[model samples]
Target: MSDVGDRNGGNDLVRFEGVTKRFDVAKPALDAITGAVRGGEITGLVGPDGAGKTTLIRLMTGLMLPESGTVQVLGFDTRKDPAAIQAGIGYMPQRFGLYEDLSVQENLDLYADLRGLPRHERAATFDELLAFTDLKRFTSRLAGKLSGGMKQKLGLACALLKKPKLLLLDEPGVGVDPISRRDLWKMVENLTEEGIGVVWSTAYLEEAEACDRVFLLSEGKLLFSGEPKDLTARAAGRVFRVSGIPGRRRQMLTKLLDEDGVVDGVIQGDAIRLVTVKDRETRFSAAGDAEVTAAEPRFEDAFIDMLGGGPGGRSRLAETQRSFTVEGEKPVIEARALTKRFGDFTAADNITFDIPRGQIFGLLGPNGAGKSTTFKMLCGLLKPTNGEGRIAGFDLRRDTAEARNRLGYMAQKFSLYGDLSVSQNLQFFAGVYGLHGAHKRERVDLMTSIFDFRSRQSMSAKVLPLGLKQRLALACAVMHEPEVLFLDEPTSGVDPITRREFWTHINGLVEKGVTVLVTTHFMDEAEYCDRISLIYRGRSIALGSPDELKARVANAENPDPTMEDAFIALIQASEEERMAA
Candidate 1:
């Protein structure tokens, strides 16, 4: 056969030709994929859920083989030289690959030993890796004791221990704070200086901008591949923003989309941005005029447009309704001076907040912030060391079951059974939530259709990609459509396209007047919440609307300001003020 098993000659570190991976009788997970990753540059593979991002990485890492076609890594046939490729490439999965019970230094030592490094060189290698990851001080701490960001950094450090020529990082910044993400990128840049090639897959399009080249995939096929600048150039003159009352934005967008020449429109809070491929047509109205203006198309806007159009139908209608609040409604959740301590550590110290009925209140902060502790207290999963809290007006300490019953909670990890198929997992969750008969079946069907779970319903939970796993978790949590929803890092590791879709579903739930309490590290997502409490070091340092907080931080005499910068500045200011006190 024409040396099909032979390696290709090039500066390319990895290559795939007509690669296809079939898990079942249906369409393959990776369909005839063809691509290459060159040395000394960063390549990003961008896609939504079920786009085969993980499958592609697995093939390259030699963890999985293609049913057809060939995969080449570092000038070796992946199939014939799978062991060699595995030895030469560093792969970090979405999940932390470290042994949780091991200490930071021990984890690094294990990885170094597993990679077959000489015992004499391990000490120097470990020290260098720890310095690069900035985990030198925490060497003796248990791996599980580290925060999410620290764990990710340690995982990366372990992956880089052997000095592999190629690195495969899958969603390394999923739940990491913006500052930590910035630091992680710096580490990647340092790796590039050593002439190491990187193939990184991420859900965040904004992060993709840092890559030398981008590969956009959809449903197991490559849609576009080139520089981030090229993608933005193609979207020029097509994007415009419309700001007004929030309630009317969706209606205006739908009306505009129905009109001739309007390509696509997106509802961004109080504004609707329209993307048009053709020349602009202005339909001026005294009430609300359609303005043709120029603005940059975000990767999210482009991804949604590329997937056909933004969400529509009953979901769109639900987004327009602001009737989540009842007349003279009482707060669904209330916290009073909640405090939690672990030995000398104050996890949540005197935290307090009130979530009004039908409102979505975001709990936001960086890793090591008390957001998770506060969330646990609210859900009755953890009892506060002092003070009190109530959920659905039920005392968290007294009426725990009553409070839990009225709420739907989704944790950061996939909390479903991996062996079970999608439908089964949903049914299992429904049962656990005490649903029965037609009530359960009807709600299950509704969730499946609403979240587009029907196509993947037969697939096992283990087989679904990160995005689908997130969707399933959301669907299960909302099966009964509880009055209050608790989403903890709901879109942490999901791709940009899936994140937008998840938000569309959340907006629909909010229309039904469901109260939402969410904790997230994604600042961009914080903008969607009605109000936010920014917690850090076991306390709430700032609580207000996102814009209000931004304005306050901006007016603080900072040199340059943006929301991201403002958050960093405000947090640093808070720490300084506390120190002074």
Candidate 2:
């Protein structure tokens, strides 16, 4: 509500005058949007899926023309002075525009040259950018070979090569680990110190707090714009956290969240954080429950409150501890002392874990933690150099087909043909998985409806947005409805609303007795699984409920460590143990 203006006393670096961008059928992405970007500050755009955050970034960067209004970057008209803006500003899309075939250094060099940095200055620019993004050590590695976090760093490096006055970042923190995100935020802070205005867009509400100012968007309209602390302070002392017995915790939270007084409740590992407008926090406490400590409202809580309550709010939180329960059967999948090596490097070493029937299991880890290799072995795509395994009661090494037939996997990149329509891709996968004719059609139809894929059937897989692409991939992966579904980071780079929608479909599948083994870098998504197995450096270091794993690695020094902190501490301890040994 309060306009802080530029702190550095410079002219407004970027100003949008009733900016409006439109498509043929859908509503205008930015509906008469007018905003100012001040120099020497970081402004964040926060919103749900399809809320025009990316569209706003594209318009500012001159990637698209506003249908009616005008967008100005660095005082230059977006439509008239497009070349000037393109020359002076850096932009990173939700998808990093890196060339997969090129090495990281080469990608940076390509962007440097494209931005017209001279030969002599190019070297210094490349070195400085690499240092800023902390990717100097991996400069020569192929961009495709790098992990998700590394790729994100590389993308930022490429964008920063020329020292643009205005920087536009679109969802830069999505899928990155918390430490990396924190580092990235620090880098943004430094850039603002140098008088470079940054307009950042992200789906994670917590990230919006670091910006000097935040603009909340919903359905292409600005809902609120102010300092995040001020906005959240409006509901301060209205939220509290409760931790106690699991059953009782869920019961109290559900009743409070559903009752008339409570505004919202978020399940944050071993605690149910509730928000109410009533101001009195003690009214909801029951016997045997831990004290409800007054807490600040998280970005997620504010966003959820803004949206009211979506479906499955309580049920989703309750399923946080969903464990695999198989009647009269051993585990359907097992990996014992698994060791995988590539040349002299070991991807997986002495790793062991088990998957039971009809369970939603998770692989939680940082980048390069051997999750991909372990996933490969479980799906029978790769053979282990040492150790033994089984899938669906079939020997993984011997009965590869028997194991493969029972398992369906969705790779990290979503191995669908992008050129084909959604329906065509589904048909192809249905046939590949042995479904034919009427049965194949029925399965495809069911998947389309299940994932809300009806409207985008005719659109090419490549043309569909990030959320639609996920739905299409999920549809293809489950065409045959295999007993076990292995999804590798299925929700990476997706928005919060779409991520919730994606998980809703996943929850439904879990209800149908389908076993799911998913790997994700997202700590929040890790909380949604029935049970999680945290893998680090090729070993299952901790496996249990999200709260249980966090408790196992619980630092008494930081008693309220989040799932992200627990994961980092766990890996740090393991790394220390390995070094000492």
Q: How many residue pairs clash in each candidate?
A: 2, 0
Which run of 10 residues does model 2 get worst, by summed lDDT?
A: 1-10
Q: How do the residues 44-107 of candidate 1 rate in per-residue lDDT, one tens digit apiece?
A: 9888777888889999988799999998888878778889888888889988889999999889
Candidate 2, pairs of clashing residues: none
Distance (Å) between predicted and true CA of 406, model 2? Answer: 2.6
Candidate number of the best lDDT: 1
Error of 2 at 557 (Å): 4.7
Q: Mind sharing the TM-score for model 2?
A: 0.86
Model 1: residues >4 Å from true position, as ranges?
A: 1-10, 246-272, 277-293, 316-324, 419-421, 431-434, 452-462, 555-562, 576-581
Model 2 stretches with alpha carbons more than 4 Å out: 1-11, 234-267, 270-296, 313-328, 436-439, 578-581
Give the lDDT of residue 16 in candidate 1.
89
